[model samples]
Target: DQQVKQNSPSLSVQEGRISILNCDYTNSMFDYFLWYKKYPAEGPTFLISISSIKDKNEDGRFTVFLNKSAKHLSLHIVPSQPGDSAVYFCAATNRYNNNDMRFGAGTRLTVKP
Candidate 1:
């Protein structure tokens, strides 16, 4: 059973446009959420994060929104750039299981220049 789900396997966007990625989770116990970006043959790098206590968190061009009631979360990249093209993964971990992070399958984002 998948705890986290990224329904869209891939997403395409024109450069300078907004790219929104969606993620859903089945476990409500999760208290922390994070977004990671990975390039070919590289490990995932932390991009942005949000605590379950907060509904939204932003860092420059990236923003993460969480909907606890719906058990869903989303990452938004405004004015998408070609450099943003990568595999994005959503991860969540609860206080009880701080060491165990549940990760989504990952969404491949392609920014067309």
Candidate 2:
């Protein structure tokens, strides 16, 4: 059941550089998208989100972009900090089926000072 997929298993970046995370989904029914960041041995924390109606959303240094036609989405973190290093998961939920959320395997991001 590969509804959502993050092809890159991990990413390495400089502390002040931009970190880009990619995600793809097979199910077009997905309307809501979210990005979650998790530290080792801890639960995922919500980082950012975008709706199908909007192609982009931004908060602070985090931005989420969605391409409905390609079933693709990406997260951009500017001036990435050491604290931003974590496992990031892409999640999706259909508006009609809000109770069920599908999540990607997750991509571990490491920032080097």
- Give the Cα lDDT of each candidate: 0.97, 0.96
The residue-by-residue lDDT of candidate 2 on 1-113, one tens digit each, is 89999999999999999999999999979999999999999989999999999999999999999999999999999989999999999999987888889999999999999
Residue 31 of candidate 2: its Cα lDDT? 96
Rate residue 104 of model 1 by lDDT: 97
Per-residue accuracy of model 1 over 15-111 as CA lDDT, tens digit each: 9999999999998888999999999999999999999999999999999999999999999999899999999999999789789899999999999
Worst 10 residues of 1 by lDDT: 93-102
TM-score per candidate: 0.98, 0.98
Candidate 1 local lDDT, residue 111? 100
Superposed model 2: Cα runs more than 4 Å off: none
